[model samples]
Target: MSTTADQIAPAHDEHHAPRGLLRWLTTTNHKEIGTLYLVFSLTMFFVGGTMALIIRAELFQPGLQIVEPYFFNQMTTMHALVMIFGAVMPAFVGLANWLIPMMIGAPDMALPRMNNWSFWIMPFAFTLLLSTLFMDGGGPAGGWTLYPPLSLQTGAAFPFVILAIHMMGVSSVMGAINVIATILNLRAPGMTLMRMPLFVWTWLITAYLLIAVMPVLAGAVTMLLTDKYFGTSFFNAAGGGDPVMFQHIFWFFGHPEVYIMILPAFGIVSQIIPTFARKPLFGYASMVYATASIAFLSFIVWGHHMFTVGMPLAGELFFMYATMLIAVPTGVKVFNWMATMWRGSMTFETPMLFAVAFVVLFTIGGFSGLMLAIAPADFQYQDTYFVVAHFHYVLVPGAVFSIMAATYYWLPKWTGHMYDEKLGRLHFWCSAIGVNVLFFPQHFLGLAGMPRRIPDYALQFAGFNMISSIGAFLFGLSQLIFLWVVIKCIRGGEPAPAKPWEGAHGLEWTLPSPAPLHTFQTPPQIDPSEAHG
Candidate 1:
């Protein structure tokens, strides 16, 4: 009689999967593409981090000792572009690729060929973007927002930057389409929408958000391209176009873009907390609804970013209240996370430590966000280090930390080897301390009337800037430990079991550790009792 493994194994042999460098270049396998995206993301993370350190080095003292003012601006601009587009977003996409099909018991993404194409496009897009830094104008320095006139001043780099952005947008949109198609069409039998994991649900919502907003950014940049070269004047003051209109259009896409980066983070944290707490996620339905609510609120609150632009009092009030309204759904998610951990057999593993930090630190960011949402208060904080601090808290601890947690949570399954927990904890503590020391003082700097995006600062801002720079170095250096841990695990470690975490519940854990090149070739049966809820 045939064994159970023989009965359930993929119809084809594993050797049928492509091999060698050509496999990575041309293969349609979700797992390989996911690895490519992840490795690319990690590479870019260091690239972006280097730019950040350059910035800190310059600001280490009140004077501009290290780099020229324009180069400083370039560092700030390029750093945001690299981190947002190159690092964090792709890292999340990589996670989705690796886990979504496994979670829902699909054999592969619905559009595997398109998935391959999506990953391939990113390298070229970023290459074109980074190439601009060497051009005469020294990259687009008007900020990643690329506000026009100032952005219009960008020289030979202009068209290249726009093209690079378009390429990134195309890649993102195609990836989003793949995600939606996969989730909607490829779920295993009995895997109902409500039964899917939060990570899948969040990506579904995020995919829609991507489809909706990526084009707006594409359009805005296209207009910028036209105004610069084709003379269309969409944001030109002399041509009777309003520069502020660019801000309006940008923020309309920009704010939802923020949620696009974050909703999945909420999803990641949602998955981790319950696993470590040894509890079914508290208020699962509420968490789903809250994520949806946050996405909805994101579109209406774009005006808050433009409050200092002198809108009418009514407009300001409306944006302020709408922005504040987001807190309701956000609060629900936070409360549910805490409740899930309440009185449970909690394990403080690396993933849980990061998850817990995400809750606390992200809440701090949220509170600071509320302060910025106050129309009058934003006037004080707008474009200062306070704004910088607020967002870093959100993106770093909030989004980046969640990504790190997911890595630790799933690395065992991916590598079939457990990461060194001792070293993992060390990375966590160093990162946690370093990130705070880097960002926290900036809030005080902004409150004390220090402006942002400048090479030099007033004498009063010196002490905090120095402290912040030290923190930046600390945080940047700590990432080496993270890199070491990942490499070490991949090379050799104690073998991991299929279910490394006792409390973990998902279809992913049903597969053998270091999940096969092909999985769910025959759809795995879903059990309602084993659902993540």
Candidate 2:
């Protein structure tokens, strides 16, 4: 067989290694590191999912039935921490590690050893985090936001939690640096910034966001640790420190952290929608601009989350307007997706199904966010189930569904095997239906005055809460189907062609299925016409 220019030439290869577990432990190969990230993210997904299930099960009947209230709080807190830091962020990084070099025709990530270090650091951090469940005072129950006063009360687990968060931040910063360097320095000849894939473009922006915000988070947590142990007054009320100041610092990082999780999803959806729709992505340049706009807007909109913090009228108005401005760029993205699908020869592949669901559902989340952005309206919605519903919609279906879509869209390329189509569709329906069942009713609960982070709810809010729990369980269990599909594809299946999706475009498709361990060792010729816009 004649090897394509995009594929690594086996005949002249000197980097080949004998297979063993040690290869994974010490390997600097980008593909191996990327695989490690992905597998680790999957494991954390299940671990976090278990915590979520515990939370839902306890909430299933309104009163404290399954776990103690303190333990329940731990479950809620740990679930958010695990999912955000351990599952979602790492999963996106995994995708970036695997796909960025492939899409850009680079040989590997710019710093291959750092890529392995970034992936390896996560397991130890999570192990320390999970170990807290069995600690003296239970895990940090003040919630994942780790607001100072309550966070200081977390007993032995407080320092451990802080250390875990610091570890995660370090890993994230290292990963971000690697991504920024890779995208900026490693593109093949003729691959200008404008010609990069949306996924690549989004990751470039996301890496910058990560580098910017992860350190802010680290600083915030470090201050908390000091206030607790080192007796610093950063957030100490007795020492003349204002707790609200902590809110200001945390949300500054928190809001951008939200974008960090979703922007890559935007990139993934941008990639998948065009492929199954049999069209080039509509307004490709606009998509890139919109992503950057959203990132810029993210930094300014942090105050919206703190609308109830009693800022002056001027401050409130400024935040409200800034928050509303985000909708414009976000609307551009939504319209572009719709335009991409407008009258194109669309097919309802599993990936397309997830991508379309992402547009509709993420928009729903965005609308609710806009509603919350109104400083006046937020007074009513603050700390309620409605607030919970808003983010879950965005994260679960929004960020996570996009991940599933990308997996389906690219798994063939990654594994050289065709996944079961019927099974894939079944997983989609379950996730779509189950997620709605899970989070949609939380809106009703929040509006009806049910507070979040409490183990028990009032008798009045029973019905919708029950419905939400049922949805949560269904949504939680349905993920097992996804796990099965991934494993089955990896082990064996019908062989996949290099271009598994007929409409797919990119240098990635130019390489053979289950892309060789090394690709683009000699930079592939970058033809402008062949690149996805």
User: Top model by lDDT, which number?
Assistant: 1
Q: Let me know the TM-score candidate 2 reaches against the reference structure.
A: 0.97
Tell me the TM-score of each prediction against the true structure. Answer: 0.97, 0.97
Off by over 4 Å in 1: 1-13
**Candidate 2: tens digits of C-alpha lDDT, residues 1-533:** 12222333334343565458877887666777888888898899999999999988888886789889999899999999999999999999999999999999898888777777888899999999999999998889999998878888898999999999999999999999889988888899889999999999999999999999999999999999888888799999899998889899999999999999999999999999999899999999999999999999999988898888789999999999999999999999999999999999999999999999999999999999999999999999999999999999999999999999999998999999999999999999999999999999999999998999999989888888789889988888899999999999999999999998998889999999999888888889988887863
Q: Could you give the C-alpha RMSD of every candidate to the true structure, in order shown?
A: 3.5, 3.4
lDDT of 1 by residue, 1-533 (tens): 11222233455455775678887997677887888999999999999999999999999998869999998898899999999999999999999999998999998777777788899999999999999999997998989999988999998999999999899899899889989988998899999999999999999999999999999999999999999888787898899999999999999999999998999999999999999999999998998899999999998999999999979999999999999999999999999999999998998999999999999999999999999999998888999999999999999999999999999999999999999999999999999999999999999999998998999999999999999999999999999999999999999899999999999999999999999888988889899988863
Model 2, total clashes: 1
Query: Model 2 off-target regions past 4 Å?
Result: 1-18
What TM-score, to 2 decimals, does candidate 1 have? Answer: 0.97
lDDT (0 to 1) per candidate: 0.92, 0.91
